[model samples]
Target: MTRAPWMAVIGLVACAAPAERSLTADPGAETTPVRPTHPSGIWPVTPPGADSPDTPDPPGSATNCDPLHLVATDIDETLTTDNDEWDLQIDDPSYDPAMRPDANTLLQGYAARGYTIAYVTARWDFEMSDGRLASEHTVDWLHDHGFPLHGGLVFLAPEPDHDGDEVVEYKSGVLLGLQAEGWALDWAYGNAETDIEAFLLAGFPDDSTFLVGDRAGELEVPGIPNEDAYTAHLAHLASVPDVRCE
Candidate 1:
């Protein structure tokens, strides 16, 4: 994970609204072996959402109110960049720290409010020379960037390509896997439609659960802050202290 500040890759769409700044992810190296930050922690578990135009997130409100679990984000177009690819380890320390996205900062806002944090992506699982599936390195990178995420998980992508539909289908497996092991989610976030997979599987059924991200297509859940970026979104919602991306 001792590489450069890179970009991301995942296919998603966005509205053609004007933006003050344009930030898109550059795909980075293939997935690597993640050295867990919390060896016993279930971080890789896909991690919630909302408020209103009139009302606001009360001080210490979401802690007892919001889901006490992870926030699932699409790394490529949504969180990092708006591309279909990522760049490999680049020691370019000045690659623009601003481009690194501040999820860890945001999670602290939520965690202070009392939720847990985790990151999940479609970065395929890694394989060893002997064909044995090894752990993924995306989490290591998260730690490298100070994302505050306890664990990270990658999808098992098909050879040809994996689309949003497949993501929608398998997300439940990931959630159940985490929940069965004692993880509970109150909110989720992402900047793409593929992010809907976790929501569909979550089936929270009320505004109590959140689905925040850059944009959510037809998700229609409450507590969801559809934004181009939470870091950017934070500027707008300065009225509240965004809990740690807890």
Candidate 2:
């Protein structure tokens, strides 16, 4: 917690909205530079070199970039299960929102063991009008619901009044601006009660916090509940090891 190497580039412009422009609903690809080991070939089984979402540097610090085991979540009902009527399905243009069975295969098995997901959504920084940026349609709906956004990072909510303590002050201010750059969030996922009070007010670790739909386990904070399927919490996060910080 000895931050200030530009505090993760000013916490990526004060939390959310900056993927180096070009997403006017796909003007031939250009978004995906929020860092997490790059690889934004817009996901289709990338993972070869991958790490160039414009590289403004903010992964870790062994002098700059290396130790980053970050995992975070919260996409309407903790990865969409009836998407809690997202304000009456946000003007339903053929709605279509249903994920949460395995919740993107448990965050693509925590991005294939290297962590770094961070999709902390309260979804609302609207700017649509053919000018794009409702967090670029929530990163094309997490790449059309296949999640694991290349080298993921989607955080949104600068306005549009999310209510309830402003969605716990905009998701604990994007997890305290990714813990002001040191970033070791480790694990997080939610379904509300203001996402366990914004992940214990951005300090995380009530045994790695998890919860899904219907007030999961009625939260008293011991977290880990995954309501009805992350298939046994993705086998209890594959035996939880790989501490990603090399």
Candidate 3:
């Protein structure tokens, strides 16, 4: 994989946390604390108390010690249909878009075989009116809609209304950070040219990149067209080897 420069990955993580970072959750709001980064610049967002802090990650969960398989995916259009409801979702924290057919099921199959899911989106880090960060809404949506969450992560843009180039940069930065921290990103899913660019920039092979929704069949992008909401892809995924720890 084309890894980002170590300094670039460090810079990206530093930018994610502003000078005035707050470790405490907002009063009375369900929140995940954005912890200080480990030396490698990747921080876990899996709710702290969900599993014992000292306990090692189970087989299917992501752990840096083992070079496990990981699947990186986009949120809008790739996983959900007509997800332009971000503004509405911010105003009404309960608003959710319809999930693409079989998207969750396909990812679950990968997770079952020990692949960690990395939800990389261009959504801004703005706080909703309900006091939850946009990332919180994303997590809730995934859980409410039955997506796999075996130690998965949700990566968001540092700012709002990202253009295509900005989206590519941010998403690529997230992938690079994961790569630096020892995750083997074997496959990637998306629905935009930006997603294609990001995945390729992060060194994913064209055959391993799948694009859904309107841009799926575009001839210019370097990704396999997944027009059937991953229904057909599930069978192919079954044949890939599972992760084996050293």
Ten-residue region with minimum lDDT total, candidate 1: 43-52
**Each candidate's TM vs. the true structure?**
0.51, 0.31, 0.79
Where does candidate 3 stray beyond 4 Å? 1-11, 14-34, 38-49, 59-61, 219-227, 244-246
Candidate 3 per-residue C-alpha lDDT over 86-135 given as tens digits, one digit per residue, 9 for 90 to 100: 65677688777778777899888877667778788777666678777665
Model 3 vs. true fold: TM: 0.79
* TM-score ranking, high to low: 3, 1, 2
Q: Scored by Cα lDDT, where does model 3 land?
A: 0.65
lDDT against true structure, model 2: 0.59
lDDT of 1: 0.41
How well does candidate 1 score on lDDT at residue 124?
51
Query: Per-residue lDDT of 1-246 in model 2, one digit per residue for the tens?
Result: 222111111122244434442232244554443332222211122222434333443443222335566778888867877565454445552355667687888887877676767777776755555455455555666666777664456665656655889878767876776577567777887877887788888888877887675566777654445455576677777676665443
User: In candidate 3, residue 189 scores what lDDT?
Assistant: 86
Q: How would you encode candidate 1's per-residue C-alpha lDDT over 126-238 as one tens digit per residue?
A: 44343323222343345446664422233333222577776665555455554654556555655556665565575533343334444543456543343434566455334
RMSD of each: 13.7, 15.8, 5.5
